[model samples]
Target: MKIRILTRIALLAAASAASFAHAAPAMVTEGILTGGNGMTLYTFDRDAAGSGKSACNDACAKNWPPLKARDDDIAGGDYSIVMRDDGSKQWAYKGKPLYFWVKDQQPGDKTGDGVNNAWHVVKP
Candidate 1:
C-alpha cells in the first residue's frame, strides 16, 4: 500500500510541474492574451510597432505597467521584447507593447480597454 501511495504522489507532482511549464510567463485564453496572473493584457495604440520603444512612460507607466520580460526569455515569432526607456525588457505581442492595467482588480477585468480610445485588449 505504501508503494502505491508513493506512485500516486509522484504522478500528481509531475502533473503540477507540467502545468507550470505550459503556462510559462504568458498564455492565450478565451481568444485574448493574458499575463501569467490571468489579468487582461493590453497595448497602447500610440506605440509604433517595431520602433523598439514604449510611448507610455513615467506617470503613464505607473497606471499601465509593462509586462516585464525575464532575462532568459527569448523573442520568437509574433512574440517580441522591447527595451523600455528605463532599460528594462518588456514583453510585446506582434510588436505592440503589453501592459497590465492597475484598475483591473482581478483576472478577466478589461477596464483598461478603450481608455481614451488608445488602449485596447491584445487578442490572440
Candidate 2:
C-alpha cells in the first residue's frame, strides 16, 4: 500500500511539472496580436519616439493589454520591462510597448492591427 501511494504521488508531481513547462510565453506573430494560455505578442510603431517606455495606458490599455513578463523571463535585444499604473510589468521591444487586442478570438488573428491607425502587427 505504501508503494502504491508513493507511485501515485510521483505521478501527480510529474503531471504538475509538465503543465508548468507547457505554459507558453508571450509570443508575437504577423497575425495574432494577443491571447491567453500563453504570452501574447505585439508590435509598436517604428516611428514611435520613446526610450524604452510605453505610451499606452489606462483607457488605451483597455483595448490593447500589454504583454506582461514573468519573473523568469530573460530580457534580450531591445526587450525590456515597463511598470504600469497597476503595478504590473509590461513588455517593451525596441523602445516600443507591446500590447494585445481584446477582439482577437484565436491564434493567427490580427484583428488589432491598424485598428486606429496607430497599431501594427509584430512580425516573427
Candidate 3:
C-alpha cells in the first residue's frame, strides 16, 4: 500500500510540472526573447502597442511568422495575447507582437532582425 501511494504522488508531481511548463509561451535566451522552441522572436514596428492586433498578415506573415498561442494559453504580467487577421491567437510581450523570422534556421539566430528597418529582435 505504501508503494502504491508513492507512485500516485510521483504521477501527480509529473502532471503539475507539465502544467507549469505550458504556462509561459516564451523565455529569454542569450539576452534575447525566444519562443518555446528556442527560436529567436522579433517584433514589427508597424504594430501598434496594446492595440491587440498584428499588422503583419498575408504575404507579410510569410516572412515573419507570429508566435502563435494556444487557445487555452493564459497571459499574465508583460505577456499578452493578440488576435491575428485570420482570427488566430498570438503571444505578445509588452503589447508588441512576437514573431519568428523565416530566415532563422536555428535557435539563437536573429537574421531577421532589422529587416527593411521594420523588424527588430525582442530584447528582454
Q: Backbone clashes in each candidate structure, one number apiece?
A: 0, 2, 0
TM-score of 2: 0.61
Model 1: lDDT of residue 100: 95
Candidate 3 lDDT, 1-124, residue by residue in tens: 9999999999999877766767578889989999988999999999999999999999999988889998877788899999999999999999999999999999988899889999999998
Q: Residue-wise lDDT of candidate 2 within 1-124, one digit each (tens)? A: 9999999999999877765662344444444434354434566563254555566778977877788766655555556666666777776665666787778766776777786677787654
The TM-score-based order of candidates, best leading, equals 3, 1, 2
Query: What C-alpha lDDT, on a 0 to 100 scale, does residue 16 get in candidate 2?
Result: 71
Clashing pairs in 3: none
Clashes of 2: 2
TM-score of 1: 0.79
Please identify model 3 stretches exceeding 4 Å from their true place.
1-21
- Report lDDT (CA) for all predictions: 0.88, 0.65, 0.91
**Candidate 3 positional error at 11, Å:** 20
Ranking by lDDT: 3, 1, 2
What's the C-alpha lDDT at position 19 in model 3?
61
Error of 2 at 38 (Å): 6.2
